[model samples]
Target: MTSSITDVAGIEVGHFTDARRPTGCTVVLARGSAVAGVDVRGAAPGTRETDLLAPQNVVERVHAVLLSGGSAWGLDAAGGVMRWLEEQGIGIDVGPARIPIVPAAVLFDLPLGDQRVRPDAAAGYAACQAASRSAPAEGCIGAGAGAVVGKIFGFHRAMKGGIGTASVTAGGVTVGALIACNALGDVVDPDTGRVIAGARTEDGLHLLDSRRALLRGDAPRPMLAGSNTTIGVIATDAVLTKVQASRLATVGHDGLARSINPVHTLSDGDALFALATGASGRTPGMMTLAAMAAEACALAVVRAVRAARGVRIGELHLPAAGEI
Candidate 1:
């Protein structure tokens, strides 16, 4: 009943928040090595070891999944996760040595805070050291620390984005999601169909409603490609094959679409990872698990924005959902 990703039996969450800047990493550790799958929907993505997650791949499980800030450079964090897992004698026994399988994704948080600073190997190692079965701290922490959304209008009108988690259970099966909301569009409440956090008007006094703006012939601000993304992980305790796990990840994106406006755009590197611990030993229907996974993911996306606090670095300040 933690209402977090840790609600899954074999999942452990950890984070490393850098004091020097608003950038860091989050690690989801399945020390027992859970069956993993991935779906990358965005045109721009920074990831590592995702190809191995394909159903036809040889590796069926991953020791950890890393979500990080610092864009492409953040992929370095996965190396640290590998080192830590190896230290714990975790990973696939390859006869001579055990090589840990760690899949990772990164979002762009460079425009906020200090762009010069980014997560590295040490940061990833520190996150592993902090891993635990407890519900993790959310909002303006870890990879979500420097996250900002509503970039369609530009960062000046964007709101603070952060980490959030939620879980759902049905028929003795449990599904959970950990979302780091950092999209190039606005976040909406699927239940209410209201814009909760996103771009602001010219005066920065109201929501610009990016979708509407685009419909009205307002072009998004020009920016470099691969500058925004929403990355996350979905965990479930249901027994599943590699294909099912991959399907779960794909269905999980439906949650993001329900909650985020104009998602999977060329500018957003949205990626989701699905990890099945199979601790429950129950093989539920695909439809049931899919529904639970999407629900959990949408809930987590909303929570990420709501729990976030306004961030002020230098003269620029990005407000949180509640503030607006």
Candidate 2:
């Protein structure tokens, strides 16, 4: 409903958080009849109900979509979403009971915050029940609360990253993007082509130069596991099948390329999802709309970085992009 992604209709977003623990989840819901699809391009994406995204899957309606913090462990939050939907009498019917089908995804945030912190079923249910007709909140909330980027070398050289969103309208169809900006690369200003935030040297006077560092024979090789990942969802009002929705998700990654440098790395669990609210049956031009969606997603990622607040990790001040 917001102008950001005004082309997508009848899509609602809700967020649940534990500020003390610095972790949470965001839920996106299609209040009415909608077609949804997903695309996972990363080598290490954590997701649920992926089978439902296949064209062959007979189930057409997804009661809720969940994005949460807690790495793979956070997947349990979907149980809460299921419980909420079940209470609302939604989902597939079997005999006298209805089972809720909530597709969910997660980003690795456990190492960034209180290691003991996690998102649970209660949080998921709260997010689903809180879905609203307003713009989604950006930065340091939901699954993005503990997200970070530009840590190709190590956490000492990382920068804070979070959630961002944008929307566009073309040919009367609307596409909106919501992104968790966690990556293994620097965030650049797409408009000016300047590094706004990224890894820094121990002295903090120079950039880490990740590519150069990697090529250096003298540089110590850092473990490439569990650094960061960017996950996103693109919602539209276009009436498309699950197959088309999957393609749109892939197309949406162009937005990530425009905003983040050295994206989709082995350490990055980048994933994108595309959904259709099925509010508009008119077929809009695909290529043009895809391009616009990418641009909007890029901008949304930048906004997420800018919106983050500083956090003290060890002895260093991990400043958020906009905080500086």
Candidate 3:
């Protein structure tokens, strides 16, 4: 068991990062296409081709999903993904050419990284080119490269967030999640309900609870529009319709709520995509798969923090688990 999203057969993972800018993109690919669904919980979301994923929509599957940083501008990564897929002759055949169905989501990392640098077509293509089924390199990579948590207390007090992945096999089926942990609230351990990664005091010595700070009416720093978002993708080999896949994406949010305190706020764009490869002809049930997917998501959240590395962002340095 690789314990990663790629563990789900028929799916591959890849990343393209700009270390200097502290921004990047992650690509989840299904060369043969995969049934896909998406759920967006946060008020501010930066996405591409999400409407088609709705059960009521026409597109039933997507060839790839892109998770990127750069706010709306990062969406250009999807075009790159499309170009790559088109070159490979992947997509819906509509007469003369095939149009690859690629959906995408983005997070806010500009406040923490080089605001001038953002993911683009080249980055998306690079990520697709690097697609593989091996266990992904977690933390401070891909879209999570510039991610930060506990932003409620403000950027100065926030902790570094990054990409994390988890997977589990149950009832002869595999469920997995790839999480980019970037929220306006604190990250808590679901089991203990204790703050694991969150805002630090102005003195940079102790962890501060976001809810507590808000309750006490202590505001730290403010941000611009689209300054925060958390995005991810959940995958399974079970056979499920678009509606079922969409429902599973909802369940995946439970995993986010478990690990991140006060999720789905107006400030954070919390979103997840559900992909069913249908490689396994058998499944315990949609509910069972959803529950497992939720758990896997929570696991990915913690792994991201644990695997993160300290990132220096102008005057401030956000420490990872080891540094903290």
Query: In lDDT terms, which candidate is top?
Result: 1
Q: Comparing 1 and 3 by lDDT, which wins?
A: 1
List lDDT for all candidates, in order: 0.93, 0.77, 0.89
Per-candidate TM-scores read 0.98, 0.91, 0.96
**lDDT per residue (tens digit) for residues 1-324 in model 1:** 459999999999999999998999999999998999999999999999999999998999999999999999999999999999999999999999999999999999888766889999999999999999999998899989988888888889999999999999999989999999999989999998789999999889899899899999997893467898999999999999999999999999999999999899999899999999999999988999999999999999999999899988888989999786
Q: For model 1, state the Cα shift of residue 309 in Å.
A: 0.8
TM-score of 2: 0.91
Instruction: Quote the lDDT for 296 in model 2.
Output: 75
lDDT of 3 at 289: 93
How many residue pairs of model 1 clash at the backbone?
0
Per-residue error for 156 in candidate 3, Å, reads 0.6
After superposition, the stretches of candidate 3 with alpha carbons farther than 4 Å from their true spots are 216-222
Q: What digit string (tens of lDDT, one per residue) describes model 3 on residues 181-252?
A: 988878888899888888888887888777687788886564554677789999999999999999999999
Model 2 spans > 4 angstroms off: 1-7, 205-224, 314-316
Cand. 1 TM to true fold: 0.98
Q: Write the per-residue lDDT of candidate 2 for residues 1-324, one digit (tens) a residue.
A: 334443367788888877766678888876564667777766677889877877788876676688888888888899998888788787778788987777888888766657777888998988887788777788888888888777766677777878878887778778888888878888888887677677777766556656555667435333355446788778888777777777788888888888888788777778787778878776686787688678878987888888777677568567777544
Q: Is candidate 1 or candidate 3 better by TM-score?
A: 1
